[model samples]
Target: MEQYKRKIALTNARFYAYHGYYHEEQMLGNEFFLDIICFVSNPTLNTDDNLVKTINYEELYRIAKEEMAQPKKLLETVVDNILNSIKVNFHEVNEIEVSLRKSNPPFGGDAATAEVSLYWQSGT
Candidate 1:
């Protein structure tokens, strides 16, 4: 038995997509960032050198990229969607988290960015 395994993550992934509440935001688009983490439990993590034995990071990035392309009004919604997508694809993961950030929101002021995050763990 290999016990538990290490986590896999894609951090600071940047995308320019039309996603926001205001009309201009949907039209003009803006910079968006994402961070996804998946904690996997696999018995072969230490023994097998095969990609199939553990979480494929490229597949994880693909899920986030696809979800980010869809325009949504709220970051929370986007985060939720990403989480669900990951859950659907990587059903064996022990824990997962997704975070989305919108850079320099239109409100002006000195606010750096608007961010939202969603997290999940197996068994309540």
Candidate 2:
């Protein structure tokens, strides 16, 4: 079997929104970083052409931005939305992994950041 992999890593994808359980946190939105990895089946390798045969990363970025803009109580929910959005929008993508990180959370702690990642593949 032939496999074509194309990875689009967007680091430090900053999104400011209220997404915490605490009252103060929910009222005051914070910045979050999102990293997305999309494993797609490249058609250009077989056809030797770049005519709508590959995934449109620009569109993916738009989708991610839209999803990230929405405020959610849990990072898990946001990650899930990102993965599901990609899966539905891009059919060529066989698998996707989304990592959402909240940098310098309101909760004062030793940890620098808090993150949640979700992996979703085709079928079950």
Best by TM-score: 1
Prediction RMSDs, each to the true structure = 1.9, 2.5
Q: Where does candidate 1 have its weakest 10-residue lDDT segment?
A: 40-49
Clashes in predicted model 2: 0
Q: Please, what's the RMSD in Å of model 1?
A: 1.9
lDDT by residue (1-124, candidate 1, tens digit) is: 4466679899999999888999999999999989999987654554757888778889988988898899999999889999998889987788998999899899994758998999999893
Residue range 47-87, candidate 2, lDDT tens digits: 66664766666777788888877777888888899889888
Q: Model 1, which residues run further than 4 Å from truth?
A: none
Clashes of each: 0, 0
lDDT of each: 0.88, 0.78
